[model samples]
Target: MNQDPLQNLRLSHPAHFLALGFGSGLSPVAPGTMGTLVTLPLVWLLAFSGQTGYLLVTLLACVAGVWICGRTARDMGVHDHGAIVWDEVAGMLLTMIAVPVNWLTLLVGFLLFRMLDIFKPWPISYLDKHVHGGAGIMADDILAGVVACGLLHLLIFIGWLPVPAL
Candidate 1:
């Protein structure tokens, strides 16, 4: 525990500026997952506004998160360290894309996102291990979100999953 997470992860690097995710990576507990979880309130609140707001925010995060995550990672000198989790936040937000504003849908989306993220299958795993800097850390999670979102969308399209009441 004496090894500071920031020091060990090297979050001070200038290039990884965005990877720090506004310092969300500094959280004590499972920083990455927690950082991702931190967005739940905002996501839930915006859910009522329809998918447009959520979509807009998620998209914005995705675009911005890349730079943030990349900068922070470079500054820290760590390659895709767990502390850098803005990718998870963006990915989770992406997973919820098009999802109706409801507890059930949110819960399902969260589960799916977490599951896919943890698994990091196929392209996600490849990018996670192969890519470098902020793109490495965030890209894989974002891809995971894409996969989860596609699955969710497919379920909805086929009538397997009903849209929740907003």
Candidate 2:
């Protein structure tokens, strides 16, 4: 009889809890997507603090994620395991920075971030390949968020997407 490998991971551990995206990363499906989806409410709430606060929170998450993800990965004996997704949470927050928190923006930002993260084009791919540890796990998703944020802003600037009055 085969036991589930993840059963050994204790969600009670703070690093494991966070790195697993509050358990959303344990989903049998696309855990990364689930992790990103679970972060939408956080993004919306942070939007109330305005861009500066949002950026600050995102920065903090990114910084802490290095340890959170790294610790969990070490425990799991896998680098950047599919079950660790704090990076996705941080990436989604970064993607939503300065953007109005509405269903549309949320959807677009989620899709864009996921796309960049999944595709890992150019520098993102390069960093993911060369980097290691918690920072290595986060580098690709962070870059994806940055690119998606830029694309999202461009969409609004070009009038392809409207900036709803806040």
lDDT of 1 by residue, 1-166 (tens): 3544366344455434345555676777777777667767777887777777778888888887777777665655556667777887888788877776566666777778888888877878898788876567678888988988898888777888887543
Candidate 1: regions farther than 4 A off:
1-24
Clash count, one per candidate: 20, 0
Error of 1 at 29 (Å): 3.8
**What's model 1's lDDT at 44?**
85
TM-scores, all candidates, are 0.79, 0.95
Candidate 2 wrong stretches, greater than 4 Å:
1-5
lDDT of 2 by residue, 75-144 (tens): 8778898999999999999898888778999999999999999989999999899999999999999999
